[model samples]
Target: MNIRNEWVSFKIGDIYFPDPQQVAFERHKDDLLDGKVADLSDHGLLKEVFAVVEVEGIEQPVIVPVDRLSGPAPEMSAGEE
Candidate 1:
């Protein structure tokens, strides 16, 4: 799987969020929520996300999973092109 760094909209569970940064923010606010943030850096398969989101109460990047994301298929990989 090839992962590309691009802006994408993703949905975690039933709630649709706009971007990875927002996903991180929501996860920070809710501890009981079970969801993952889409990893734009990788493709083909969902994986853990390692992004740094600047939240008002948190001082670190939130690490979430990728399986919770459901959205339009990612752009074709270099080899696919």
Candidate 2:
């Protein structure tokens, strides 16, 4: 699948994951934007989008949430903090 707009960066939350899982994501950083939307789930007001990406050392493509892929960075203000 082709995505019209590629993400500028990827930012995974500071969460724990198995060593293998972590490595998979890191290895596919460059191709993350090429991932395809394999599935989507409806959650009332929100819809969850999942992407299928191939990672090094992993035989099967991994599925991850679209939100994990960063878009335009949000602007912050000094007073907000």
Candidate 3:
């Protein structure tokens, strides 16, 4: 889902997951502007979540919920961080 012109995505998985935040950002092949996650307790299932991936130009982020997301996101650049 998209919100405030940006996009957000959420993920849920094993109890020993690395950083969920990092994996969420990796899912996107394109650059993200700015975004974050939101709570969705209405479902009563905590396994679900929301994400906010910032979209360029639109000045907003998109949101999506998924299960079993990958591990730490791949390095964005080769240069020193």
Candidate 4:
């Protein structure tokens, strides 16, 4: 088995969060643009997710992806090049 890291497990090396086809194709958004809210299921079971979250008061299933800006730590700021 491939010993992949925890962070990489949810991602298939793509920047996007693997959203539905409509958002992926219709929107023509970039992979790094992040993913939108979605209801995911597998084997007729609802899985629990900690990272992705739904919109507040939406009363609907949502699975939005988080966007992490690329930047070095404050201490390493000088090293950025």
User: 1-81 in candidate 4: lDDT tens per residue?
Assistant: 776764543333354655555544655555333223334334213334323334445465444322332333354456545
Per-residue lDDT of 1-81 in model 2, one digit per residue for the tens? Answer: 786696655445534465655776687657634333334545222536655655456567877676674532234222433
Q: How close is each model in CA RMSD to the real structure? A: 18.4, 17.6, 18.6, 17.9
TM-scores for candidates 1 onward, in order: 0.25, 0.30, 0.28, 0.17
Question: Which pairs of residues clash in candidate 4, taking residues 3 or more apart in a chain or in different chains?
Answer: 37-63, 38-63
lDDT of 2 at 71: 34
User: How close to the true structure is residue 78 of candidate 2, measured as C-alpha lDDT?
Assistant: 29
Among these predictions, the greatest lDDT belongs to 2
Ranking by lDDT: 2, 1, 3, 4
- Tens digits of per-residue lDDT for model 3, 1-81: 447877755444432476665665676556533332333334525557544434345554555553433322345223524
Model 1 spans with C-alpha error above 4 angstroms? 1-39, 43-54, 69-81
Query: Cα deviation of 12 in candidate 4 (Å)?
Result: 37
lDDT scores for all predictions? 0.45, 0.52, 0.45, 0.40
Q: What TM-score quantifies how close candidate 1 is to the native fold? A: 0.25
- C-alpha lDDT of candidate 1 relative to the true structure: 0.45
Q: Which parts of model 3 have CA positions greater than 4 angstroms off?
A: 1-45, 55-58, 66-71, 77-81
Global lDDT of model 2: 0.52
